[model samples]
Target: MKLKTYDISLVGMFAALMAIGANITSVAPFLQVAGVPLSMQPFFCILAGLLIGSRLGALSMIVYALIGIAGAPVFAGFSGGPGVIIGSTGGFILSYIVAAYVAGRIVERSQNPGLPSFYTASFAGIVLIYVIGTTYMYAALNFWMEVEMTYLGAWGIMSWFIVKDAAFTVLGAVIAPRIYKSVHRGARLGRRSAA
Candidate 1:
C-alpha cells in the first residue's frame, strides 16, 4: 500500500525512536560480548515492526541507520558516523532492518495477530536478527578486521542479549497491539470526520 502522511510520520517517528532507544541510559549494560556492546535497540526495532507493519518498519530502520551513518550522534552510547556502521557492532545495527521487516510482515499478514502471534513473530524476528548479525560479525571480524573470530565464537557473543531480548519481545507483544489499535481507531475517526 501507498504511504499516507500518517504512515510517513509514523515511520519517521519510529526512526527517531530508534535513535533515542539506542542512546538511552539505564537500558542495558555497556558490557561487551566478543567486542559487541549489549544494547536494547532491538526493542524499539521490533516495536516499530509491530506498530507500523513491514514496509514502513524496514524503512524506519533504514532511516535510523542512514542518519547515524551520516554523522548523527544517534547510535548506541551516543556514537555515530560511518565508523560505527563499519565497526564491530554494525552487524546488529544493520540486522534491525531485517528483524523489523520480518516481524511486521508476519503481523500484517494476520487477520488479527494478538499477543501470542506477535510474540511468536517477534521471537522469530529476533532469531533472524541474531543469525544475520552474528554471521556478519563473524565475517567482519575475520575478513575485514583481521580479528580471526570463528562463527561459533560470534554466536557466543549473542548469549548476552538473548534473554533480555526475549523479555522485550514479550513486552512488545503486549504493548504493540494496543498502540496499533489506538492509532487505527484514531485514523478511523479522522476519516469519518473528514468525510
Candidate 2:
C-alpha cells in the first residue's frame, strides 16, 4: 500500500489548534497588582507560532478566539462567548494573533543548521510574542480601565506574563526538534518500505 503524505497546511492547522488548546488548558489564576488583574497565558500563543510557523500560527489563534467568541468554551477556565473577548483580557487575546504570526515567521525562516538554529528561532519567536502581548495588555488596560500605571507597574505586569511564556518556550524548544526529526525519519522509513 502507498503511504499518503499529509498536507503541510493541514498539519500546521492541526498543530496550531492543538497548541491553542494546550494554552487554554494551561492557564492559572490571574496575577493582580494594584488592582490590575492579568491572566498569564501567552506561552501557548508563542508555542503555536514556534511550532506551526507564522501564517498558520496566527490563523490558529484567530480561529480559537473566534470560536470562543461564538460561544464555544475553548478559552481558559472553560470560558466562552463574546464577553471574554471584550473583557480586560481581550487585548491580550487579540495580541496572540500578532505574536503568533511574528513568532511563526521567525521560526520558519530559521529552520536551518539543525537544533541550535531551531531553538534560536523559537527564542526569537518567544521574544516577539512577549513584546506584542505585553504592549497590547498595557494599552488595553490603560485606555479601557483608565488605570494610572507607572513604567514599573507595566514592567511588573510584563514580567509576570513573560516568565511563564519563556519557560514554556524553552521546554518546547528542547522537545520539538527531536519530535520533528523523529517524524521525518519515520516518514522516510515508510516510503522506503513502500518502494
Candidate 3:
C-alpha cells in the first residue's frame, strides 16, 4: 500500500522517537536487575504499532535499526554500527520490527481497538519479541560469537528484562488508543482543510 506524505512523516517520527527512547535512562544507571538496563524502546515500539498499524510500524522499526547501524548511536548505551547489529543484543534490537508488526496486526484486526485489544496485542508482541530475541541471542552467542551460552542460559538472562518490558507494555496499552485517535483525528482535519 502506498503511504501518504503524512503517513511517511509519522513513520519517520516514530523512528526518531525510538532512537530518543533508547537514549533515555532516567531511572538510575547503576540499577541492576539481573544485569539488564531499563529502556523505553518497548513502550515506543508498542505505541508505533498501535498508532501506525503493522506495515508502517514494522517499517518504522526497520528505519530505526538502519539509523543505529549507520553509527547514529541510537542503540542502547549509545552504541551503534554494523558490529552492534551483529552483536549479542542485536537479536533484541532486530526483534522490534517483528514485535511491532505482530502487535499492530492484532490491533488492526480487532473490531474495537480498545484496552482489551491493546493489552492482548502488547502482551503477545512482547512475548514474541522475547522468543525471537532469546533464540537469536543463544545462536549468536554460542555459534557466531563463540561466547558459549546454552539456550536456557540465554532465556534466563532475558527473564530479567521481562518485568521491565511488561511495564512498558502496560504503558503502551493504556496510552496507545488515545494517541492513535488524536493522530488520526489530526490527519483527518488536515485532509479536510486541504480539500
Candidate 4:
C-alpha cells in the first residue's frame, strides 16, 4: 500500500499544475478606482506560494507568464503574447513570480503553515509585489508617457492593487489549507486503496 517515490513526485507536479491553472483562470482586468488602474493578480501569487511551496509556486507563475507570452490565450481577458508583458500590466505580471517565491520562502522557513502564518506570508508577498510593480509602473509611465509620475500617483496606483490583493490573500489564507488537506487526504486514501 506504499506509494512509490515517483508517484509522490508526480502527484506534487499535478498539484502544482492545478494551482497554476487556477491562478491563470483567476486573472482579472485592472480595476479602475477613482482614476487609478490597479492590477489584482497578486492574490493568485500568494495562493500559489502557500499551496505549492516557494520554488514550485514561483515556477508555476513563471510558467504561466511564459505560456502567455508565447501566445497562449491564458491571460486576463483571454489575452496572450509577448506584447502583454511589454504592456502596462507587465510589471504586475512579472511581480507575481517574486511574490510567490517570497511567500513560499517565508512559510517554509517559519515551518508554520498555519492560517496566521500563511496570511502573514501572503501579506508580505503582496507587499513585495507592490513595491516592484509600483516602481516599474512609475518608470514605465515616465518612459512611455514622457511625464514624471508623482509620489501620490504611485501611491494611488498601489492602493487599489493592494486592496484587491489583500482581499484575495484573506480568502486564500482561509481556504488554501482546507483545500490542500482535503486533496492530500483524498490522494493518500486513493493510494492506500490502490495498494
Candidate 5:
C-alpha cells in the first residue's frame, strides 16, 4: 500500500520519540532498578503501534535501531553503535519492532478499537518485550559477558522492569484513544488545507 506523506512523517516522529525515550534515564540517574536504568522505550513502542498501526510503527523502530547502530547517541545513557546491539540490552532494542507490530496487529483486528482492545494489545506487547529482552540478556551475560546468571535469575532481574513497564503499558492504553483521534483528525485537516 502506498503511504501518504502524513504516514511517513508519523514514522519519523515515532523514531524520534524512541530516541527520547531511550535516553530519558540519563538526566535522572536515580530512576534505576538493580543498577539498570529504567527505560521508557516500551511506552513509546506501544504508542507507536497504537497510533500509527503495525507497518509504520515497526519501520520507525527499525529506523531508530539503525540510527543507533550508525553511532548516534540514541540508546540508553546516551550510548550507541553496533556494540550496543551486541550488548546485553540489545535484545530489548530488537524486541521493540516485534512488540509494536504485535500490538498494532492485535488492535487492528478490530474495526473500532476501544479501551479493552488497547489494554489487551498493550499487555501483549509488553510480554514480548520482556520475554525477548530477558532471554537475550541472560544469554549475553552467561555466554559472552561471563556473568553466569541462570534463566530464572534472569527473570528475577527483569522483575523490576516488568513492574515499570506494566504501569507504562496501562498509561499508554488509557491515553492512546485520545491521541489517535487527535492525530488522525489533524492529518485530515492537514490534507484539506493542502488541497
Candidate 6:
C-alpha cells in the first residue's frame, strides 16, 4: 500500500512514542537486566503494528532506530548514536521492526480479527522481541565484550522481563482493537458524510 500524508504522520507519532517509551523512567538499576535497561519499546512497537498494519508499523520502528543512530538521544536511558547499535541492547532495537511487522501481518491475515487474533499476534511479537534481543545480547557479551554467558543463562536473565512484556502485550491487544474500531467507524462516517 502507498503511504499518504496521514500514514507518514502516524509513523512519526509512533517513532516519537518509541523515544518516550525508551526513557520513560530513566536508567534505574532496578529496571535493568544483565546490563540491559528495560523499556516499553515492545509495547509501542506492537501497538503500531496493531493500529497501522505491518508496513507502516515497521516503517515507524525504522524511523525510530535511524533517529537514535543519528545521535538524537531517543534511545533507552536517553542514550543514542551509532555506538548504541553496537551495544548489547541494539538487537532489541532492531527487533522492533520485525516484531511489529510480524504482529501486524498476523492480524492482517484475519478477515475479522478479534481478541484471540490480537492476543496471538501480540504474544508472537513479544516472543520475537525477546528471542532476537536475548540472542544478540548473548553474542555481544560472550564474543566482543569478553564476558561469559550461556544461552540458557541469557534466557534466564530475561525471565523477569518476559513476564513484564507479557503483561504489556496483553494490554496492547485489548486496547488496540477498541481504538481501531473507533477510528474505523469515524473514517467510514467521514466518507459517508463527504459523499
Count clashing residue pairs per candidate: 0, 1, 0, 0, 0, 0
* Cα lDDT, all candidates: 0.82, 0.62, 0.85, 0.69, 0.90, 0.88
What is the C-alpha lDDT profile of model 2 across 1-195, one tens digit per residue? Answer: 222343244344553454345344245334444443333345556656666556656776787778778987766666789887666556666777887787667656763635675567667766655565566666666777687676467768667556666766777777766665555566566657656
Estimated TM-score for each candidate: 0.87, 0.67, 0.90, 0.72, 0.91, 0.88
Q: After superposition, how far is residue 120 of candidate 5 from its true place, in Å?
A: 0.5
Whole-model lDDT, model 2: 0.62
* Residue 20 in candidate 1, Cα distance off native in Å: 1.3
Model 2's TM-score against the true structure? 0.67
Highest lDDT model number: 5
The parts of candidate 6 lying over 4 Å away from their true place are: 27-38, 185-195
| Best candidate according to TM-score | 5
Better of 5 and 6 by lDDT: 5
Between prediction 2 and prediction 4, the one with superior lDDT is 4
TM-score of 6: 0.88
TM-score of 5: 0.91
lDDT of 3 by residue, 15-130 (tens): 99888778676436665556676777878887888888899999999999999899988888888999987888798889899989999999999987899999998998898888
Candidate 5 residue lDDT tens string, 1-195: 566788789999999999988877777778787777778899999899988888888889999999999999999878999999899999999999999999988888978999999999999999999999999999999999899889999999788879989989999999998888888797787677767
Please, what are the lDDT tens digits per residue for candidate 4 over residues 50-110?
A: 7656776777677777878888766666678988777666787788888888888887887
Residue 78, model 1, lDDT: 86
- Candidate 1 vs candidate 5: which has greater lDDT? 5
Candidate 1: tens digits of C-alpha lDDT, residues 70-120: 998898778889998777889889999999999989988889778877887
Name the regions of candidate 5 deviating beyond 4 angstroms.
29-36, 188-195
